[model samples]
Target: MATKNVLIVLSSHDLLGSTGRPTGWYLPEFAHPYYVLAPHVKLTIASPKGGHAPLDPGSVEAFKADPESVEFVQTKSALWENTEKLSTFLGRAKEFDAIFYPGGHGPMYDLATDPDSIALIREFWEAGKIVSTVCHGAAALTHATLSDGSYLVADTPVTGFANAEEDAIDFSQYMPFMLETELNKISGGKYEKAAEDWASHVVVAKEDRLLTGQNPGSARDLAVVILEKLNA
Candidate 1:
């Protein structure tokens, strides 16, 4: 079997919706998946503008004790140091076997509305490649329209950072849009949640080539699911 190449897209937006707080890719969301998938597949990181993808300060501080997070931050991995612009890889979607997006409040500001991001996702889906995102990263699915002119996520079972979770964190008001509410309204799919906030909850829309995780806690599970689907 050939080695599977996975593209990981991160958000370039660094501000947290006028809160005057800084934000970027969630540390755990990217680290957990990177370690889980790195040993088995080739991983490439990209962002809207390229260069060093900003790190969410809170995420770094929160997971600072975790060795994986520590290693990610300390190592000068080329993936994070030299991110390619999403626009430059638009026509090369076929070169990858799967694409993953890691969550942070930042995705809500940029990846969610980036034309190239949405187009690349649609292209990967249309070509039968696996597409996955976790937490607010699900926002990236918001504007994806299929060739038939229907929302790519329409009627597909998916999960993302729930509104209740947002409420728990007390940051919903600062968000440009409610992640869960928007996902439900746009996808028209059954959006399920865990009984407790921050618990692992993942939904795989088998027929849609889509996989989504409910929050940062579900990051590893989401990566495992993608690996299973790819290996099967």
Candidate 2:
């Protein structure tokens, strides 16, 4: 079988809302997935403006004990240092077999409403390609709609950083909008979450090829699912 091409979109927004704290893509959310899929697929990393996608320092500190996350920072792989521009692939969704978003609070600020990102996602869904996200990465799906103008998640089983999870982290007030609230508003009862906060929860609407993970803990699991879908 031919190799699959996956586009990993990271956030360019680095500010953590009005708190004046720093935030970007979460370290493990991207690192764990990259390692799981890299050897088997072709991956391209991109950001809104191309170059130096920021990392959420808090995540780095929190997951510092994690070897993969540490290696990603200590080694400074070419992936995050020099990401291609997200807009550069706007009209080329067909060139990829899938698109993945690994989250941080930053995406809630930018990727959630980025026009180029939304268009690219729509193109992928319309092309019947896999659309995947983990944690707040699901923010990228908040504004995407179908060709008929209905929400893409309106009838799909989806999961994201839940309100409970957001509250547990105490970063809810610093958010532009609650990730769970927005996802629930548009999901039309299709949004799901684990019984408790921070638990691993992943949902895959196989028929639609829409896959989502509840939080950072679900990152590796989500990537494994992406691989399953890619190789199915």
Candidate 3:
């Protein structure tokens, strides 16, 4: 079997919606998947602006004691230090077997509508490759229209950072748009959440080749599932 090549896209937008707070790719969302895929596949990280994908400070401080998150911050600087621009991979979706988006509030402001990002998702989906994300990363899927003019997640069960979770953090107002709400609209009301708030929730729309995780707690588990799908 050939090695699976995956592309990980991060957000370059660091502002938390005019609140003057900073935000970027959430650490656990990226780290968990990184470690899971490191030993088993070829991975590449990219961002909209192409260099120094920012890490949400809140995540770094929040997951400060998590061994995986901490170790990632301490040792994986090189992985995200210089990413290829998303535009660079525009028509090259077949070069990779899959594409994953690690969420942070930043994507709400940028990746959600980036033409190249949207185009790439359509390209990958059309190629029958896996397309995945966790939490607010679903922003990247909100506007992706397929060649047939269908929203990629339409009618597919999917999960993302829930509105209730946003309410818990008191961040809903600062978000450009509600992640869960938008996903529901795109999925034709097929969006769902874990039974309890913040618990792990992953929705694998196998027929559509799409996978999504509900929140930070769901990141690692989602990666495991992705590995299984790739290995199978």
Candidate 4:
């Protein structure tokens, strides 16, 4: 069998909805999955503009205790230093077996509306490859349309950072749009969540072609699910 290759797309946007606060891809969301997937598959990191992608400072602080997060920061791998531009990877989706998007407020700002990101996702889905996202990374699916002009996530069971979770952080107001609300409205899918905020929750839909994690806590579990699918 050939080696599995995964494309990891990180948000390049660094602003937190005009709040004057800096935000980028969350540390654990990328670090956890990277550590889990790296040994098993070849991984490539990409972003909207390529080069260094910003890191969410709060995420770094919050996940500092995690070993993977610690190694990710201490090593400063080239994977994070020099991401390829998303545009360059478009139309080459078949080269990869799967694609993963890590979340942060940054994705809500950029990847959600990036034409290249949207097209790449649609291509991956159309090709029956695994497409997964965690937390606000799910925003990338917001505008993805199938060949039939229907939203790719429409009528699919999915989960993302819930509105209540956003409210709990008191950061809901700063967001350009609520993730859960947009997902519920746009996907017309059965969107549910864990009873408690920050708990791990994952939903696999579209016959495993679409997988989503509810929040940051779900990152590792989501990676495990991806590994299972890849090995299956």
Name the candidate that leads on lDDT: 3
Each candidate structure's TM-score, on Cα atoms with residue i matched to residue i, is 0.96, 0.97, 0.98, 0.97
TM-score of 1: 0.96
Higher-scoring candidate on TM-score, 1 or 3: 3
lDDT scores for all predictions? 0.90, 0.92, 0.93, 0.90
lDDT by residue (tens digit), candidate 1, 40-101: 99988899999988889999899989998889888845666689888988878789989999
State the lDDT at 100 in candidate 1. Answer: 96
Clashes of each: 0, 0, 0, 0
- Deviation in angstroms for 128 in model 3? 0.7
Q: List the residue pairs that clash in candidate 4.
A: none
Give RMSD to native, each candidate.
1.2, 1.0, 0.8, 1.0
Query: What tens digits encode model 3's per-residue C-alpha lDDT throughout 185-227?
Result: 9899999999999999999995747999999999999999889
Give a tens-digit lDDT track for model 2, residues 130-198.
999999999999999878898889867789999988888888989889988888889877789999888
Candidate 4, 1-232: lDDT as tens digits:
7889999999999888878899999999998888789899999999998998999999889888888898998885587779998899989989999999999889999999999999999899888899999999999989888788898888888889999889998899899899999899877757878889999999988887798999999999999999889888
